[model samples]
Target: MAPLSWYIALSASLFVIGLYGVLSRRNVLIVLMCLELMLSAVNINLVAFSFFLSHLGGQIFAIFVITVTAAEVAVALAIVIAYVRHKGSLKIDEISIMNG
Candidate 1:
């Protein structure tokens, strides 16, 4: 059986990678994917802690996170589609019309 610390380390690494992707990527779709990756990392940590501590709270929170993530993805994708329709591109740097 793997230790709790190992799970935590893995989660942390995933979070860092997601952060890097968000910061370094230029495509809006890629950035959204990174955001999902970050959310999954959080879910991993929640499940790992729930397993280690034998508590239901972490699992419950993870479920809530999943619900929120779904809502966020729905709203975000709608916005992305709107932006693409208006701008004809998915690159973040190219869509600078709102920078006033």
Candidate 2:
């Protein structure tokens, strides 16, 4: 069995990469994907700790997180598609409702 620290390290790395992508990327689609990656990293940590603790709460929470993330992605993508159609640009810097 692998140690819990290894799992934690992996999760942290994923989270950091996702955060960097979100902060540095200009494309809205890529930013959404990075946000999903961050959510996945959280789920991994939840499952790993749940397994280590011999408890089901973390696993349950992870499932809930997955469900919510799915809904968020669906809604966000719909909005992104609409925005792309209406604005004609996917760049984050180009998107703003307050300017209109």
RMSD of 2: 1.0
lDDT to native, each model: 0.94, 0.96
Please write out the lDDT profile of model 1 over residues 1-100, one tens digit for every residue: 9999999899999999999999999999999999999999999999999999999999999999999999999999999999898879998888788787
After TM-score superposition, what is the CA distance of residue 56 in candidate 1 from its true location, in Å? Answer: 0.1
Worst 10 residues of 1 by lDDT: 91-100
lDDT of 2 by residue, 1-100 (tens): 9999999999999999999999999999999999999999999999999999999999999999999999999999999999888989999988978797
What is the lDDT for 76 in model 2? 99
TM-score of 1: 0.95
Error of 1 at 28 (Å): 0.5
RMSD of candidate 1 to the truth, in angstroms, is 0.9
Which candidate number would show the highest lDDT if scored against the true structure? Answer: 2
In angstroms, the error of model 2 at 32 is: 0.5
